[model samples]
Target: MNYYKDNVSTNVVTSNCNYVVTVKDWPAFLNEYNNFSNTTLAAYNAAYLQLGGGGNVAPGVSFLLKFGAFLNLYKADPSSDEYMPLKLNQNNA
Candidate 1:
């Protein structure tokens, strides 16, 4: 997820059943998450690379910038409602 300016945000969600599995056990959930991260990151990186570069930045630079900005915004105003209403949609079998 990424936050822009005061109240704007964006995110990416995968429809793959293997992603974001809901399990009661923390360890199992984390293990599944780790696996998903590896696959998702690889796919994202590939697609990002195909988009070419942005000026002096690399293909994945835009995503990194947005993520960094979001982190900064969160750090600045953690209690702000601008970051609320976290919308998470799970797509899986």
Candidate 2:
């Protein structure tokens, strides 16, 4: 998905740190699954849990996927799944 371009419309600094929203009918949902401000990692985990438990099967605003949750936790290795400092550790080892 072109998750970057559109989300920047909302906030650029938080764009790279955002999670993609796959729930198609989120605008119709409520409670713990409604607020746009619910961008924490915990909130993101909750949403995915709900989906795994048989939530909606449709795609929401395809453009707003990365706009739902905040994803900038720790630094990631740009070239791999390892943490950002993994390469440094490897070299020193």
Tens-digit lDDT track of model 2 for 7-89? 43222223234322233232343343456456887877566546534343222221223333332222332343443211112
lDDT of each: 0.35, 0.35
Off by over 4 Å in 2: 1-38, 54-93
Candidate 1, residues 1-93, lDDT tens digits: the string is 223233343332333211111223445445645765878787766654544352444312333332222232111133232332222123210
TM-score of candidate 2 relative to the true fold: 0.19
TM-scores, in order shown? 0.21, 0.19
Model 1 is weakest, by summed lDDT over 10 consecutive residues, at 15-24
